[model samples]
Target: MKMEFDLRMTQEQKLIMTQQMQMSVKILQMTNMEMQSYITKEIEENPILETEKKSKEKKDDIDYKELIKYLDDDFNYSNKNYYVNNEEEVSPFTFISAKKSLKEYLIEQVIDLNLSESLKYLCMYIVEDIDSRGYLYTNKNILAEELNVEISTVEEALKVIHSLDPPGIGGVNLIECLKIQLNKKQITDKEIYLIVENYLQSMADNKYAVIAKELNISIQEAQRYGDIIKTLEPKPSRGFYTGEETNYISPEAHIKKINDEYFVIMNNDEIPKLNINKTYKNIIYNDEDEKTVKYVKDKINSALFLIKSINQRESTIFRILTKLVEVQRDYFDMGEKYLKPLTLKELAEMLQIHESTVSRAIRDKYVYTDKGTIKIKDLFITGIAQNNYDDNVSTLIIKKEIKNIVESEDSKKPYSDQKICDLLKEKNFNISRRTVAKYREELEIKSSSKRKRY
Candidate 1:
C-alpha cells in the first residue's frame, strides 16, 4: 500500500465558480417580466450600461400581446380589441398612460391616517405581503413574531389597513375577504356565508347534491349561492400596483401579410440604444486613480459583455424563428392546421448550433404575426402514427382526437382509459394505455369512473 501523488493536467481545465453557474441558471429561469426588472436594475447599478430606446416606435411593433393571444387557448376570440383597432375617431392621443400602483394608492391613504412611523412601517410590510388577489398570504402570528410585537398590534394594523380603498383587500384568504365584503354590504344570509366558506370546495367540484346534503338545503338553493361566489373577484390584485414586474421577452420578429407574401421584419427596434459611456472612456484615457481606472475598465467590459450577450440572444432567437417561419410557412399563410412538423434537433443541425441553444431560444419565446402571437416552442412536434393513407399526424393532432373522443362519449357509459388506448391504437397511434391516460389527465379530463353520470 504505497501512495504516489502526481498532479498533471490531462487537459487544460478552468474551475467555474458555483455563483457564476447559479447566476446563469437564475437568468435562464426568469420569466420575461422578471427579466425586464432585472435588466432595468442592472442598468441602474452599472454606470457604463444603458438601454437603447428607438424613436418613432410603432404601437404594434413588438407584438408581445399578439403572440400571447395566439398561444393562450382560453383567450377571448370575440374580443374586437384583440384584432387591429379599425375605428377612425379623432380622440386626443395620450403619449403615456398614467396608471397608479396599489402600493402607491395605499401609501396615499396612509398619509391621511394619523399613524406613527413604526405602525406605518408595519402597515407597509403587511401591504407588501398582500398578493395580487388582495389576500394577505402571510400569517399575522408570523408578522408579530418577526417584528417582536404582540399579535394584537398586528391585528390592529390589519384592521386599519383593511379599511383602505378596494374593499376586502387585506383578508388572509378568499373566504375571509368575501366575509368582509358581505359584512360591509350588510348581507346577513347564513346560507351565503356557508356557501362562501364551506361550500366553495363542493361548488368547484360541481358536487351540487353533496353541497345540498351538507348544508341541509335544496340543490337549487346551493346553486344560487354558487353563482354568487362565481361573481366575486378571486384575484384582488387585478390592475393593482405593478409591485415587481416580471421580466418579459420582447419579440424579435414581426410577420405580416402583404398581398400574397408574408413579410418577416426583425423587431429589434425597441432595445435601448447602447454605446460606451464617453465619460468612462475619458477617465480611462486621463490616467485617473489606479482603482478608478480599473473600476471604469470593469464597467466598460461589463457593458460590452451585456451588449454582446443581448445581441447574441437576439440573433439566436431570430435564426430559430427564421427557420421556424420557413418550415411553418403554411401555418403563417393559411392557419394552425397547416402547421408543419419541426424538431429541436432538426433546427440545431441546420443552424450549426446545439439543440439546447435552439431549445433556449424557443423557451418562453414567441413570434408576432398578422394573425396573432405564437409561442416559438409550439412549432416543434413529435408525430403520431401514420396510416396507409399517408396522412401525417402530430402529437397535438392525437391529443385533439383523444379530447374529442372523451367529449362525445356517453355520460352513462364514459370510455375507460383502457378503451381510449384501444381506440387510439386502432386508429394506428401506437400509443400505450398509460400514455393515453397521461394525455387525458393533462387535458384535465376525469377518469371514466369519476366522469360517469350514473
Candidate 2:
C-alpha cells in the first residue's frame, strides 16, 4: 500500500445559512400574532428600527369583522334598557355577565347546606383543593393530617363535596366522577353502571365483546348502552371558567370571490409596517465620533435587513396564497368535495421554490375563505388515484365519503373495510381495503366489530 500525500486544490460550492437568512425563514414560519410580538421586541431592543405609520395607504383597519358577523348577529351594546328593566327577557348577547368561579359556586352551595359550621369549613377547605378538572387531586390522608382532623372526617366532607351541583365535581378519580354523574341522572341501569365502574378502559378500547361476556349481555346490547355512556362529559369543568384562557385561531389572509375570479386579501391589521427611525436617518457613518459611526452603521444594517426579511416573508406568503387560490378554485367555488389533490413538493415545483419554503410559508398559519377559516396546510392533500383515469381524487374527498358511508351504515351489520372499499368502487375511488382501513383510522372511525350496535 502506498500512502499518497499530494497537495491538491478543488472547487466546491455549499449553501450557508446566514443570520439574516435564518431570521427570514423564522419570520416565514411565524403566525401573525407571533410576528407581531417579534416585531414589538425588535422595536424595543433595536433603536434604528421603528414601526412605519402609513398615512394614506389605508391598510389593516379590520380584523375578523366578517368572521364575527358570520358567527353571530351584531350585538347592540348601547342598549340602556337592559340594565333598567329586570322584567324584559335577557338575550344571551344583551350583556356580558360576571360569571361565578367554580370555587365560589361550590362555596355558595356549601354555605346554603344545613350542616355544622366546623363541618362546612372543612368542606370549604376541601373544595379549595379541587383541581380545574373538577377532581379532588389532593391526598385525603395528607389533607386530614394538615387540618388536624381524622381521615373519616375528611371523607365525610368529601361526601358532601360529591353531592354538589355539576355532578362530577369533587370526584377523586374518573370512575367516581362518572358514578356521581350517573347517580345524579338517576341511571339505575346495572349494566351501564358496571361499564362505567369496571369496564371504562375496556370500553375506550372498543372491546364490546369482552364487556358483553363479563356482563352476561349480548355484544349488540353492550354497544347500545355504550352509546349512552358516550354522552357523558369527561371534563366536568369544561365550558366553566377554569382561570385558563383559550386562544382562538385568527387567519392571516382572506380569499374572496369577485365576479368569476378569486383574490387573496392580506390580513394586515396586526402586522406592523417597519421603517428606520427618521431621527436616526442619515446618522449612519455621519457622526463626529468613529465609535458612534460604527455603532450606527451596524444597527442600521440590522434594521434594514429585519425590514427586508419581513417584507420578503409577506411577499412569499402572498405569492403562495395567490397560487393556492388558483389551484383550489374548485374547493372555493363548489364545496370540499371538489378539493384538488396538492402537496408541498408539487406546489413548490409549481411555484418554482423549495418544498421547505412552502411548508414554512403555511406552518401554523390559517386562511379565511367563503367556506370558513381553515389551516393553510389543509389545502395540500395527497391525491388518491381513481379507477383507470389520469386524474387523481383528493384524500379529503375520500375521507368525507368514508365518514358519510359509516354514518349511514347499519349498526347491526356494520360495513367492513373490504365492504367499504367495494362501496367506494361504485363511486370510482379505486382504493384498497388496507387504504380504507388507514383512512378510517385517520378519521377516528371505529372498525366493523366496534361499530356494531343492538
Q: Point to the candidate with the largest lDDT.
A: 2
Could you tally the backbone clashes for each prediction? Answer: 20, 0
Off by over 4 Å in 1: 1-36, 50-131, 136-172, 178-195, 202-212, 215-233, 239-252, 283-295, 389-392, 449-454
In candidate 2, which residue ranges exceed 4 Å CA deviation? 1-6, 50-134, 144-167, 216-221, 239-247, 273-275, 278-293
TM-score of each: 0.65, 0.76
Q: Give me the overall lDDT of model 1.
A: 0.68
C-alpha displacement of 281 in model 2, angstroms?
Answer: 4.6
Residues 250-319 of candidate 2: C-alpha lDDT, one tens digit per residue? 5767776779887676765667777655545345425577677667666766776676677667778888
Model 1 root mean square deviation, Cα atoms: 11.6
Number of the predicted model whose TM-score against the real structure is largest: 2
TM-score for candidate 2, please give it. 0.76
